[model samples]
Target: MTKLLVTGAAGQLGRAVLNHLLETSKVSPGDIVAASRDTSKLADLAAKGVETRKADFTDEAGLAAAFAGIDRVLIISTDDLATPGNRLKQHKTAVAAATKAGVKHILYTSMPNPDKSLVSFAPDHLGTEEAIKATGIAYTILRNAWYDDNYLMSMPHNLETGTWYTAYGAGKVSNISRDDCARAAAAALANPPAGSTTLTLTGSESLNAEEIAALVSKASGKQLNVVHVTDEQLAGGLTSAGLPDFLVKMLVSADANIRAGNFDLVTSDFEKLTGSKPQPLSGYLANNKDALLSAH
Candidate 1:
C-alpha cells in the first residue's frame, strides 16, 4: 500500500483534503497519514484507521521521522503569518525532512503567482517553491487563490458601518472556495501528475471590491459601499482599528496585490482537477450569511 501523509492535518484545509481523499476519492483510510503538531488532535482520524503522527516543522528530526515510509506528502502552508520568515523556516525544514526521508513527491499549497504577487505572504511561498525544486524531488505546486470566505471577515463590520474599505481600486480577484482548493489538492494527491506539475486553482468569476460589496448588500439587506483608499491610508486605518501591525501590513499587501492585477487571472484548473465548476460567491454567501453576521 502506498503511504501518503498530509501535514497540518488539524487545520481546516488539511481536514478538507483528508476528508475528500477518504470520502470522495475512496482512498483507504489505512493508507493515509494525518499529521499535525499535536497527534492527539488527530484522534478522530486515528479512530478511522488513518495513521496519525506528530510532525512539528520546528522539530527537524521529528518531521523527518514522520515522513518515514511515506511516498507522497502534502505540505500545507502554516498559519503563522504574524512572525517574519518563521513560516519559510518551517517550510524549509519540512522540505529538508521530506528530502532526507526519501519521499518521492512533495506537494505544496501556495498562493497564486507567488513570484509576482504583491501579497506579503508571497515571498514565503516563492521561497518554499524554490526550496522544493532545489531538492530534485517530483513535485506538485497548487497555487490557490484567496478563499471566498475571506471577504466575510469584513462582513460584520460592513453590516454595522455600511462601508467596505479596501485598497483594491477596480482590480478583480478570482477567489475560490477553501473546500474546492482542498478537493483539488486531494485529487492531485490520490493521482499525482507525471513529473513536476504546477496548477493555479481559481474561482470561475473574477470580481472587484465593488462587486463583492454589491453581493454583500444583497445578502445582508444593507446598503454597502466600497471605500477605496491608498495603500498607506489602508494600513493606517487598519492599525487604528485595533488590528495588530503585522496583520494590518498583511491585509494591506493583499489589497495591493489585487490593485496590481495579480489575482485577476481566471483558470479552469480547479474544474480540470475536480471535474466540477468552482463554487460561486453567491452560493457561498447565501449559505454562510448567518455565520458572516456573527464573525465580528
Candidate 2:
C-alpha cells in the first residue's frame, strides 16, 4: 500500500483535504499520515487510525524523518507572511526534506498566477515552485483560486453597512470554495497523474464585484452597493480602520490584482479532477447567508 502524508494537517485546508481523503476518496486510514507541528491538535485523526507525525518546517532533519517511507507528500503552504521570504524558506526546507527522504511524488497548494499575481506573497509561491521544480521530482501544483470563504472576512460588515468598497473596477474572479478545492486536492493526491502537472482549480463562473454584491444581497435579503475606489484609497481606508500594515498591503494588493484582470480566469480543472462542477458563488452565498449576516 502506498503511504500518503499531508503536512500542516491541522489547518483548515489540510483538515478539509484529509476529510475528503477519508470520507470522499475512501482511502484507508492506515495508508494516510497526518503531520502537524502540534500532534495534540490531531488527536481526532489519530483516533481514526491515521498516523500523526510531528513535522516542523523549521527543522529539516525532523521533516525528513517524518517523511520516511511515504510515497507521496502534500506540502500545504505555510501562513508565515509576517516576515518577508520566511514562508518560501519554509517551503524550500520541506521540499528539500521530501527529496532527501526519497519521496516519489510531491504536491503543493499554490495561488493563481503566482508568477504575475499582484498579491504580496506571490513571489514566495513562485520561489517555492521553482525550488520544487529544481528537485526534478514528480510534482503536482494545485494553483487554487480565491476562495469564496474569503469574503466572510469583510462581507458581513459590508452587508451591514449596505456598501461594499472595492478597487476591482470591472474585473471578475472565478472564486472557488475551500471545500471544493479540498475535494480536488484529495482526488489528485489519491490518484496522481502519470507525470508532473499544474492545475488551477476554479469556480464554474466568473463574477465581478457588482455581480457578487448582487448575489449576496439576494441571498441575505440585504441591499449592497459596490463602491469602486483606487488602490491607494482602499489602502488608506484599511489603515484608518487600524488594520496592521502587512494585512492592509495584502488586501490592497488583492484588490489591485482583481482590477488588473489577473484574477478573471475560469477553468474546468476542478471538474476534470473530481468529475463534478464546483459550487457556484450564488449557492455558496445562499448556504452561508446566516454567517454572511453575522458581522465579526
Candidate 3:
C-alpha cells in the first residue's frame, strides 16, 4: 500500500480530502498520514488509525522528517497572504522538503489561469508550480476554481440588504464547491496519473455576477440588485466596510481577474477525476438557502 500524506490536514479542505480518501476512495486508514502544525487538531484522524505528524511549512527539516516513508503527498496551499511573498516562500520550502524526502508523487491545490491571473496571489501559485515541476517528480496540479461556498461569507448580508456589489461586469466564473475540489484531490492522490499533469477543476456551468445574484435572489426569496462598480470604488467600499488592506486588495484583484475573463472557464476534469458531475451553483444555493438567508 502506498503511504499517502496530506499537509494542512486540520484545515477545512484538508479534512474534506481526508474524508474522501477514507470514505470515497476507500483508502486504508493506516496507509494515510495527516500532517498539521497542531497535531492536537488532528486527534480525530489519529483516532481513525491514520498517522498524524507535525508538519509545518516554515520548518523545512521538520517537514522532511514528517514526509519520511510517505510515497505521495498533497501540499495544500498555505494561507499566509498577510505578507507579500511569504506564501510563495512557504510553498517552495514544502516542495524542496518533498523532493528531499524522495516522495514519488506530489499533488497541489492551485487556482485557475495563474500564469495571467490578476489575483494578487497568482504569483505565489505560479511560482510554486514552477518549483514543483523543477523537482522532476510526478505531479498533479489541480487548479481549482473559486469556491461557491465563498459567497456565503458575504452573500447573507447582501441578501438582507437586497444589494450585491461587484466589479465583474458581465464576466462569468465557473464556481466549484470546496467539497468537489476535495473529492477530486482525493481521487488524484489515491490513484494518481502515470506522469505529471495539470488539471483545472471547475463547475459544470459558468455564471456572471448578474446571473449569480439572480440565482441567490431566487433561492433565498430575496430581491438582490447587482450594483456594478469600478475597481477603485469597490476597493473604497471594502475598506470602508472594515476589511483589512490585504483582503481588500485580494478581493478587488479577484473581481478584476474575473472581468478579464480569466475565470470564465468550464472543464470536465473534476468529473474525470472523481467520476461524478460537480454540484451546480444553483443547487448549492438552494441547498444552503437557510444559511444564506440567516447569515449576517
Worst 10 residues of 2 by lDDT: 255-264
Compare candidates 2 and 3 on lDDT and give the better one. Answer: 3
Per-residue C-alpha lDDT of model 2 across residues 87-113, encoded as one tens digit per residue: 999999999999999999999999999
Candidate 1 worst ten-residue window by lDDT: 287-296
Local distance difference test values of all predictions, in order:
0.92, 0.95, 0.95
Please provide, for model 1 over 96-213, each residue's C-alpha lDDT reduced to its tens digit, 9 standing for 90 to 100.
9999999999999998999998888899999999999999999999999999878777778877888878899989999888998999999999989899989999999999998988
Residue 288, candidate 3: alpha-carbon lDDT: 92
Candidate 3 pairs with clashing backbones: none
After aligning candidate 1 to the native by TM-score, how far in Å is the CA of 81 from where it should be? 1.8
- Cα deviation at 98, candidate 2, in Å, is 0.3
Candidate with the greatest lDDT versus the true structure: 3
Off by over 4 Å in 2: none
Model 3: CA > 4 A from native: none
